[model samples]
Target chain A: MSEDITLSLDDAQALSLDVLQHNGFSRAHAEAITRSVMAAQRDECHSHGLYRLIGCVHTALNGGIDTQTEPEIVDKAPSVVIADARQGCSLLAFEKGSALLVEKAKRTGIAALGITHCFHFSALWPEVEALSSQGVVAIAMTPTHAFVAPAGGQRPLLGTNPIAFSWPRPDGTPYTFDFATSEVARGEIELHRRAGKTIPDHWAMDANGEPTTDPTAALAGAMRTFGGYKGSALSTMIELLAGPLIGEVLGHETQAAGPESTAKPFHGELIIALSPHVFLGQDCDHHLQHAETLFEQILGQGARLPSQRRYEARQRSLCDGVTIPQALYEEIRRLGSR
Target chain B: MSEDITLSLDDAQALSLDVLQHNGFSRAHAEAITRSVMAAQRDECHSHGLYRLIGCVHTALNGGIDTQTEPEIVDKAPSVVIADARQGCSLLAFEKGSALLVEKAKRTGIAALGITHCFHFSALWPEVEALSSQGVVAIAMTPTHAFVAPAGGQRPLLGTNPIAFSWPRPDGTPYTFDFATSEVARGEIELHRRAGKTIPDHWAMDANGEPTTDPTAALAGAMRTFGGYKGSALSTMIELLAGPLIGEVLGHETQAAGPESTAKPFHGELIIALSPHVFLGQDCDHHLQHAETLFEQILGQGARLPSQRRYEARQRSLCDGVTIPQALYEEIRRLGSR
Candidate 1:
């Protein structure tokens, strides 16, 4: 029963910060990292939450990411902010660039942020969610590590690139959802492998490049993009928009050029913000009403909204606590002790 | 062999215009309509091409679409073009508004176009492609008739709701694609039904709300969104963006509200145009190069680019012309002669 005990969000954040600082990050850097971790845990995104702490430590130790450097931002245009992430963690860069992004978007009706040399290590929803909370319609995209094959191809040449979009509502929780272009996230495959379960046929391909239900083989080979050509095309769009458009490494070249980018685990990120103040004006509430009408119809049919599951989980975790594997908590404690 | 006879692009355009004129469309409106039809036929988009000519005539005659008016355009902001289609065709609205869109996007680095009270009958790619050819990055989203079921629900609540994005290339063909948020296009399902064939189980659902391979049953019920919940969310995003964001009818309400507005066949359309001149500056060539590099890598893997098939078809259609059934040609001729 003790092993099954859960931790409150505040306690988890404190413990995460403590462990991160023990692993050699400064207070500011540790705070930024822990904030994202706690948010993910609150959302019950276990893969990106406390479980990623060990990976973060390993990345820092192996120079896979820098934690302390500041982002250098340049005003490319009245509506464009170009931030050189300085081979550091993405959270800090996004945090530092938020003020400029918000101000520019409000002024111009739309703004774009290109963050280069970012090592994105957390869920992307938070980035756009922050903007949506400010009543901005926001979209965020970034090239991921390559693990997905293109349609009609055997080789993995594209990232399971993810796109996140959010629209502000009057009540303000936002109609927000983040999804990987792949049929299933790589995390799901890992879970299946651990659970000794066979995945559905569309989830991935075996090492021999044939569709396989075995998660281990799927991992050894590549993941399939959802909806065949449509998802692959969307992933391709993300790679170009987040990579080359922002002057960062292409997804296919990420591995081949690893030595060229040892200190950064990610290529770049693109953030777009649109202001209802300038564009929709008084129509924001009107738009929100129509959205609610559709939502009612969806809910009436017993279909959950896009992020409903995560949202429900977040509410539950906030009321109760976040459950974690006892061994993982012990490991974090040991790291903090050191 | 006469059934396989082809006509030049000019002849096809003329023939299409003749048919439309015979059906009561003014010269200006017919020209605009034919331009899109010719482009679709040239690109070998058979589903959206000449096949829909009869339906277009019927729609106009039944007062579902108006052919005797011009769209009223208002420049809401320097970068926002709002066009009231006045219960007319989407192409005329787009054509009338294109100049303002180009000027504003060039001046502001980005622009948004909202066209309301119009019926969109052709593929969306051509809308964005028009802007891409003007050397601007473009995106377009619009709702359709509600035929798609939400992810977990059985009843149809959303449209196919297509979104199109285009990145202008230096060589001028551009990287453009348009795809519906559904698993398969309704046109394809109709084709399968006519051919007495079964569709894939994932493509649609039966009236019993079960996944069905029977195309007729699928048509009787609802089509599924492409990638389960993800596609459903994308569809929802499109519904809001193209509907209320642009001041038009929502998909779920389009049918219910039809009697309220017997004149407008469509809800609305949203067009977003961004200038690489302002955003990329002289680096436009560099960005184009990188895109081409990705295209090369994609081609090397034997994966066709999203619009490559259409492009190839267009080239061939330009050279050899489009092939239509002899019976269909006579039908068109009969309509044109009347």
Candidate 2:
């Protein structure tokens, strides 16, 4: 069994920062990326926590990421902010443009931020949670390298295409959900492959368009979207909104451009923020509180609210710190040292 | 089997307008409602076609819709347009607000339209299609009466909320899709029940929360969201964005206010528009054409695109007209005479 070691969230972030900087990321990039990594660890989202450092270092080493480029902000219009990540990490781009997005949404009721030319590896929740914490409802989406097939299709022509949403609450954590449009996350299949386990039906297909339980064959073939055609439709919508609408490469284009050795996919992201104060004018507080009833009803019926688990984990991690696999910790420490 | 009759798209719209006017809708409301019904018929989407007139008449007779009230528009913010339907039908409110949404999006890159105090029965594709046709990407969503259970909950606490999206295609009809967030639409189960057939599992649960294949039991109990927790999260998002964010009623609240006889659900609708020209400046044309490659890839792989069927049906309906059951035609004519 792999041993585990404990670390404070702050320590986790510092370690991430050290690794990122050692991998040649600029200060701003390292700081922004560390924030998201720390957030994932704090919420015990293992896939995005310190475990992701290996992929980050690999991407940087393989030239999939530009560690020196700074994001360039463009105030496109009254309610649109565009960030040209200049082929750097998406974290800094989102960080720089989000303030303008919030300002515009506050002034105009809704605003959009488009981040282009970036390598994205983090979950979208942190971006939306940041916006929602500032009292605006937030939506974020991005297209990764094409790895999923469209509904009724044979080949992989769509990305996992993650989408996230955050709704502000009057108190406590905001309601949030971040999910890939694929039936399962691409990482889940990788995990299964590593364990030499069979995947469930409807998760993927073999290259010949045949259903397969073999994780290796599924990865070599195509992932399937959840809910069939409806999920496929959403994945396509993300491809349009975050891809062509922002003048960025689509999923297939990103896939075609990559070396395929590094797991990183360079693409664009779209974030939209809507302000309740701007939408409702004087009734903001009352309306925001009224939304609590719906949440209460969900909890009262034993149905879990999205992000409730994450928030609970966050509370614990804050009070008692977090644990990581000892071997993984050593691996990250070695990367930082390099 | 029922006998069928064919009618041109113009005749269909005229018939819808006549029936709506005879049923007490104002001229603007009648026109707007007729437009949606006509489009549905033209696209061979039978559910939203002339068959919807029955529900409209039923709701109007049951005092669920206020036909005399004109939609009141408010320029709520720089990129926000609010249309108060004053307890009237939603179609007119959306029609009134969409132009402003397009205008704002053209000016500011992104914009939102909120239609409140209305009873919505139409599919959201029409609203999004309208915006997409005006050269922008569009999204539309609304919460209906609570008929769906949250994931893990036995009670129906969320609406079978519908979301729609449209992406501009430059030449032909834009890519469009609108679907209920439920595993299967409520009407699908109702049709199964009326036909004395069993529904598929995963569509709903019995009152005890046990999965069931009985449509009647499901209807009397709770419908499930599509894609499990992911779809549930989306339905909840629609509830929040269209409900409290707009100072409108949530799904359960709408259900609590209504008499059980009418199928109409009074609520709010949200529409968001994003303009590519505003986002990409002078590169709009090149980027839009670039998106065609992605579409080609999907088509090339023999994977069907969203709304391809609708567009094909539209072509046929425009050339060869559309068919409806003679029984339905007679029923609508009878309502018009009334």
Interface Cα RMSD in Å, per prediction = 1.8, 0.7
Give per-residue CA lDDT, model 2, range A129-194, as digits (tens): 999999999999999888999999979988999999999888888999999999999999999999
Candidate number with greatest lDDT = 2
* Decoy 2 TM-score against native: 0.97
Alpha carbon lDDT of each predicted model:
0.82, 0.90
Chain B TM-score of all predictions, in order? 0.94, 0.97
Ten-residue region with minimum lDDT total, candidate 2 chain A: A255-264
Clashing pairs in 2: none
Q: Cα lDDT for residue B236, model 1?
A: 88
Model 1 lDDT per residue over B1-338, tens place: 54654788877788899899898887878888888888898998887777678778878877777787888988877567888888778888998988898887888677788888887888888888899899888889888888999999998889998989888877748888899998888989999999999899989998889989999999999999988888898898888777866667787666412434564466788888877777678877787687778777778878888898899999999889888777777777778864
Q: In model 2, what lDDT does residue A111 have? A: 95
Q: Please, what is the TM-score per model?
A: 0.94, 0.97
Name model 2 segments beyond 4 Å from true.
Answer: A256-264, B256-264
Candidate 1: lDDT of A30?
Answer: 86
